[model samples]
Target: MADITIRLYIGPSSSDLRELVVPAERPLGDLIIDWKKVYLLAEQDSQGEMIRYQLYRESEGKKVPVDPKKSLRDLRFQAYQELFLTDACHPWWQGTTSQPTTTSQSKAPGTAPLRGPATSKRVTTATTPNPSPSSRPLPSFSPCSIELAPGCVRQIGETGVVINRDYLLRELPKSVSTLERTLMWMRQESRLLAVSRSDNGHCSIVWKQSWYLMAHHPVYISGTKYSRNEAIQIEETVTLLLGRDGWPITIRLHSTSITR
Candidate 1:
């Protein structure tokens, strides 16, 4: 069989959409390594830490990670499906304090000392924000940054739009009237924002501390009804969230379902 062609959107913090043609049976692990090579990241960084990449696909307003070991075709990824890329060890949204808090005098209880010359080298530290009343201090920088753009739901579709909160704040209108008017413009297109869920299964907006799922009102994604107990019989498109943990990290949606 001939090689398959697919479009991929790769980003750590910021994403760029691109197209590629590769063997249909190639494992995603090799593809990630190839991307790393393109970016010129060594197998291990200067700190002697192995660099690992995580793949994610946007589904049902969530970033669902893709497994690296599976073949592209086995994953059922269709042509032009968008995929996200990020460093597993050093996610940009997470803080730098992930490193062990240790001192030359002594190690913490149950903690092991750093091994080898890697310990001697000083790594770059990310700026940390002050801890909020409800949240721990957030990292100022992550290995990956999400790229967000201002667009209404009508433009992006029912899955909902993903935007960088910081970017939105910076680009927000200075006047309340402008903000209200802009939101009104968006409201004209659609209501009912799709809430974001964390990897921990908590319903909270990423990178924001004060926000939480205060209330959930069941609103149909489509005019039709759906149930987990029943098989989806309609030709209409449906985005199903499934995974071993049941965290809804992977999406299975039919592409041609839109046209039919």
Candidate 2:
């Protein structure tokens, strides 16, 4: 994999941001090792080597810790993506030299376990500010997204809106939004190569994430019934192409699937 340059945040503030080029194939843990080499606080404390660090990134409006075992490529990280390689014991945030200690326990509830060793010195770190509700760009398209099916008690994202990610869109929010989210869901679930929507609202979801998905004729797609519009009959089994895992990735259902 080629190297990718990402915006790296060392401290909680914007000034701590830096552009760093990292190997796209390297595990995230490598960044922590590199951090120890530069951060002054990485030096051995009185009790020997002490102080821990971790990488975190913004996710759905929260600063979530990234799995150090995962590589940048595994995460489908985009070049513009930013990362938080934070130092929890930096002098700007540190307030004690009392006693150096080593333990996996978190000083307080609801905090990540210390990476290295630390003393009893307790300090609150600055939290990244939450983005404004309207921070997302306004859409410019025919809106179409998922919504509660009449009276069905569906838990937020449990619907097909989010086949993979834990996010949900409004019912009939935007068709583009549904298409984007559906593609993402397919990618994580199987070897999805492509997605193409017909003239109707129903989409052709073809992926290698399943074995042989042989349904009866007039199969229900996106909750709408559809029959074969092609020459293929109900007795025929249409094959979806390009199988790395196996067959059954392509489909030819057409207009009948959409509710006029």
Candidate 3:
């Protein structure tokens, strides 16, 4: 059988995104285990630590959970599609475990930014308690939703200036430099959560979980789709904006898998 093409997103963020071509012979679950060995070692679990991951295939504008035990051949896998791999136990959007763990935060209004990465013991989000004073202020995030493309509706907030859909990862615009610059101006961030599956009620932020999962690609700023070619810009922009807290704060890109 011919190899199937997949743009595998290790997490909700685009930074861990990778396109893979693989044989369709093995079960999806088995493949995922192997993929981790080859591509990701940073997530190595400690002794007796368990990390739960969920896979979803974007089809007809919906994210359908995949049965890892099923083979791609059995699923009639297609070529060049987006596959999202996320932590099922700790959803990125929520940044907390299925069984929530409460982290202590200062009870002062406006003392902390509602959105950001989680600390060793804190998972910050609109749902979490106020962060401590030591926590830095995140950029003012203005989030808006739009539609024109199918299978893309998750909302990712913006950092500095928002770019129009024309400049997203969709069709090429008149200038590549313009697109690059547009992306540069666009902010993105990392939302890697730090929850241990080894035991419940023992969750803490590692790699620091963040408060925002912007659903970036589909809902960036406002409008349209983004072409894969422009995806690299997404990466660079994230890196550039990560530590910046000036006029233009960093952005977090949380994209839904688009079906096409």
Candidate with best TM-score: 3
Q: Rank the models by lDDT, top first.
A: 2, 3, 1
* lDDT per residue (tens digit) for residues 1-260 in model 1: 45777765442222234567877787676676566545543333334434456667668856677777687788877776666565554343233223211122222222211112323432323353333334743323211111222221122232222332222334444463255346656785211123123222211122111111111212122232222221121122323222211112111223321221
**How many angstroms is residue 129 displaced in model 2 relative to the true structure, after the best TM-score fit?**
21
| CA RMSD (A), model 2 | 19.5
The C-alpha stretches of model 3 lying farther than 4 A from their native spots are 41-49, 93-122, 128-260
lDDT of 2 by residue, 72-180 (tens): 8988888967776644433222332221112222233222223334442334445533233258333222212222222322321111122211222333235634664
lDDT of 3: 0.40
Please, what are the lDDT tens digits per residue for candidate 3 over residues 141-252?
3343322123333344332223333223332233633544455567432111111112211111111122222222222211222221111112112212111121112333
lDDT of 1: 0.38
Score candidate 1 by TM-score against the native: 0.34
Considering every candidate listed, which one attains the maximal lDDT? Answer: 2
lDDT of candidate 3 at residue 78, scale 0 to 100? 77
Q: What local distance difference test score does each model get? A: 0.38, 0.40, 0.40
